[model samples]
Target: MADDKYYTLAEGCPFANNASAVLMRGKQGSGLGLLQDTQLIETLAHFSRERIPERVVHAKAVGSYGEFEATRDCSDFTSASFLNKVGKKTPVLQRVSTVGPESGSADTSRDVHGWAMKFYTDEGNQDFVFNNTPVFFIRDPLKFPSLNRSHKRHPQTHLPDANMFWDFHVGNPEGIHQLLILFSDRGTPKSVRYMHSYSGHTYKFTKPDGSFKYAKIHVKTQQGVENLSSQEATRIAGEDPDFMIRDMFEAIERGEYPTWNIYVQLMSPEEAENYKWNIFDMTKVWSHTEFPLQQIGRLTMNRNPQNYFADIEQAAFSPSTMVPGIAASADPVLQARLFAYPDAARYRLGVNYQQLPTNAAKAQVYCPFQRDGAMRFDDNYGGDPNYVGSWIKPTKFYQDAKGIRASALALHTDHEKWVGEVSAYTSEITDDDFVQPAALWEVLGRVSGQQDRVIENLVGSLTGVKYPELRRAVYSLFGRVNNNLGFMLQERTEAVIKTVQN
Candidate 1:
């Protein structure tokens, strides 16, 4: 007999009958099934092992399938094949996230947002793991753990403590530039589409001839920047914690795709040597006037991920993953992340995490030397030599004379510098640190009530600090930002504290 409907099991098997549908029971209406019950055991086993570990940071993120089209020729800067010709479209998956907060936290939190993108090109995967802001908190690699710890919940309380966050910020005054931007409305972006992504770390874009240019990337949304007020963000956090994610998904679903104009600010090696601000400093911004952005491409998120778990959650991106032309700079933070991100991914996923569908590269990856790890799904370079120095097989590298010369030139650098005392990394507030914040404070005054709101916000958080010394140090840091501003926080915070005490 023919089947009325498509005959199928949960796994799409053409099952003729689902036998043993009736539950076997004893006289008292209670029974224990034997090992014969295969379906129940199979279902439970599959469900138990479905999830992989979520990312420690950028855990709550939304991703979409898109295309990055080169809008202008940039052959002079880099030889990246994706950017070789104008109008070249490369498939891209972009994920935007709120850092620090867990996967379940509100999307509208006032925090640094992660803007990571993975480009699937013919060459390989080029991951642009960046931030929404153009600068970051700390520059030193050693301070990374401490910086993340400060942003995270306190160990003892296990609660989001403002004191820990502020104390770290005050102590690490190199973060002043980023701190000013973070507390501003930019932190509370109304939607992902309205936000901009910045390659805060300087990267090297090399030519086929081994010549390279230091380039900073910027992605300005065509949607234009939009922000949420503190009150709006608070209300939205309560009403709809997943507001940003839902907004992005629905917008794409409705065919209202968001696009960003991608541009790069380039600096020659010669100019980098004499640049006023340390090019490697994550806290400092490269002057736009000095190195203006040259339009290179446009990125548009046209489709959302079909399955969040498969496409978004399992996706891995690392700054260390680069194509031939793109390379990392000597920026300490970038150097740290080059190692840290991949290490974290391996821990969160597995040692063979790159074998996963979302993280796998499209380009020809011939790394037989890196074969045979746990969960290695690939052929394991079948019958091939896994180690180096094999007489039977030889390794081939497509290196030109220029590449070899460049390697020699790099090794010849006489960059001798004194190594000082190594201690836990920290930044003491100085005059140079306050110069930017003071300017930002004046700029805030131009926006009606913004300056007052900033001061009020500063005072509210400052009063919560438990240590008197730390509190005074914070005030001193702000005092350097602006003496009047410091006095205001001191006076206002004291009054508020006294009221609470009474």
Candidate 2:
């Protein structure tokens, strides 16, 4: 017996299997299409509206379904159920993408990669919107748009402008560390499976008692770190624009699952007060020697999405999608992202985007207050009061394992007492900012030919800057990182510029 179902219209009205168009035929075998063909009209209309808005950044990505297994209990640090017991597992969706590139852009482009993961836990959904690098371009929230714009196309030229890129970095010198790393081999990972990821912003892992410790999450690739050189990446981009995406998909298809060890560098509030660098600074990394990496879990991607557009493309993640016991810190850039990410999702997908299958929480949710938006499919909390504090239908609330209502928890120990005073504030450049980049430079030098590769990559891009002043400013910016780096960039960049001019 045939098991196949007959193909039909979207509304389930089955039509005869025949030529789609209804045409008025003449004796000469010529025909004019009739306007009454519902099938043809519907197909065209749906095709026109097929695509949703692509992400402004990290537009191109490879996603996978995975499991995060708790390797070590973290009950002392966080009461998050997913990490509270050994051998416990949580379902996860992972997406790794190149920043500043469109959906059709080359996967091997020299750029930062975004590593976003969503954990479907018992409490709710938790998202780790991370980066391959441990630090970011800027720490200040206000510079976010400017930083992205500088990396994107020039308004008038509609092309990537090296002058704009260099000028922004030179002006905002705190990004030197990230720039140096970006120009290095690490910027071009061989595949998404081979690169490590980090939570660039410090987060808080709170216990049930309202006590929390600052944390920077790190996920080291079990497949090991593998990167492509500038020449190799360029060749791959020309040869196979979707190289990384294909690599991941084929690997999973062959049962070669990619895995990562999750760890966190944790610091107490008391320790953060005396730390050398500000814990909230997104541009700086917490030293492993100082805080130390504590193992939490292991993540393994074992499944591929059956449909990319529905399962991966529509999936939304935000830093604000925190479960109980895991929360955001006071990092300015992180604070901005918490708002920006959800807002962008609402605009790109819809206000009801969370109702989509991929983005919905596995745990039960009861937010009647968030009802009645575009594409709202569920019952709008039938007969239940939308507003809070209704005596007629009092809503049930959750309590922790200790039987204490989460809402009644004491104020956080790190909460600041305010005096109703406000002042204008902006992060200023200081010698401290360059300290990490200089150290990273020295570390790069320790690897054979790594420093030269960095210099070559810098010169390759820096040579595109038509303005001599901008080139000089970039050299000065590097000089702050290391005198040798500054000299090499200046000499190599100018030599290339002159050769190109001649």
Candidate 3:
């Protein structure tokens, strides 16, 4: 009798009862394998094609399996089954990443961290493709490509160019708030476990009665917020590029799982109508004082992936993956991402990427219309009717919490009642754009040396810009936020440039 646990070939055949490679050996042990050795040929072939296309953005990341337990009944706010009752638990997958770095880049890089979570609910998968910050660089969907490209390597030099980075921001100064946050200590989070994640785009928390309220989701770390100083982050990047990833893994291994408290800031439709700032603006944050966070649930990461490639690397998440109770708002950036994220996944993974175990919905999925593509290993609906409205085997559609068929739900909302003629539109920077950043600078003053540290961080990157005029434009942009902030940045940056030139 053979041990069932013994190592075997991929097809479950014993490898001649030996673990050694089947190689043709000479007298002196010089060996060359023949192509007839199926094991050797198969191993080499698989090794050659092991890698898949890395994500264009957020290439470097760490992921873990988790569970979200609803602590408060949120049925009034949303009909999402996962949050319908207290103590309801849903399996979740979370991936935290640095947006601007390559897959091989240091984990401590000073960049916005992408915080994406997928909830495998009883209804379907609901994904929150969020960020560590509550705001983004650009609100206009048209500028999305330019914003990402500018932060990425220069096409001509194939290097990170500060000129390109500053030129884009200076031209589109609406990102000033996010820039201030990025330059602050918050940019260099101590680890994924210590940072809070926010849904920068407003989402709709809908009920079964055709009513909904605008919401911004927040996940606050239970371990408490911690940050690395600019100097410390740079040092860690040099000494241990995988610092954050290792910290998270070792902590979980020790049974000390990381946890986060989920909260949502809700606003009524009437309130959003007269809001001071555009609720749809990704660049703006809802005032916490007015729309206080309501406790929703808690998330705990208690399991680590057995295989990183199979679990984390292949997992695909998108804002479009919503269930019956939740839906997307008319925020232009959010609208664009609903299409871009899934499309990117299809290109990176295969068209049948959703069938991958990591991305597959835990609930029963029966969309025969979405049937075929390459790498589809499922039954592909078998003998069932692929087309809808068939009397032989009609497909069943999900219903809302109120027993209303989802298909019968209204397609339009009060927010979509714009009567203006269709025309091209671009967001322009205004005094309102700088108001929040100025307030943030003042907030930084509350903490000792925080404002100075931010200026130092700014100077560190801004000094790399070879063009003087571009640097000045950045200074002017910050100046609009705060006169003193602009002055310190200009003075310190110029001093650094002058010293280097001398």
- Report lDDT (CA) for all predictions: 0.82, 0.89, 0.90
> Which is the leading candidate under lDDT?
3
Candidate 2, residue 318: the lDDT equals 97
Q: How far off is residue 345 in model 3, in Å?
A: 1.2
Model 1 pairs whose backbones collide:
none
Q: What lDDT, from 0 to 1, does candidate 2 have? A: 0.89
The 10-residue segment with the lowest total lDDT in model 3? 397-406
Best by TM-score: 2
Off by more than 4 A, model 1: 1-23, 28-30, 389-429
User: Per-residue lDDT tens digits of candidate 2, residues 101-142?
Assistant: 799999999999999999999888999999999999898889
Worst 10-residue lDDT window for candidate 2 reads 397-406
TM-score for each predicted model, relative to the true structure:
0.89, 0.95, 0.94
Q: Give lDDT tens digits, candidate 1, residues 102-205.
A: 99999998888999999998888999999999989888878877888888899998998878998888778888778777877787899899999999999988
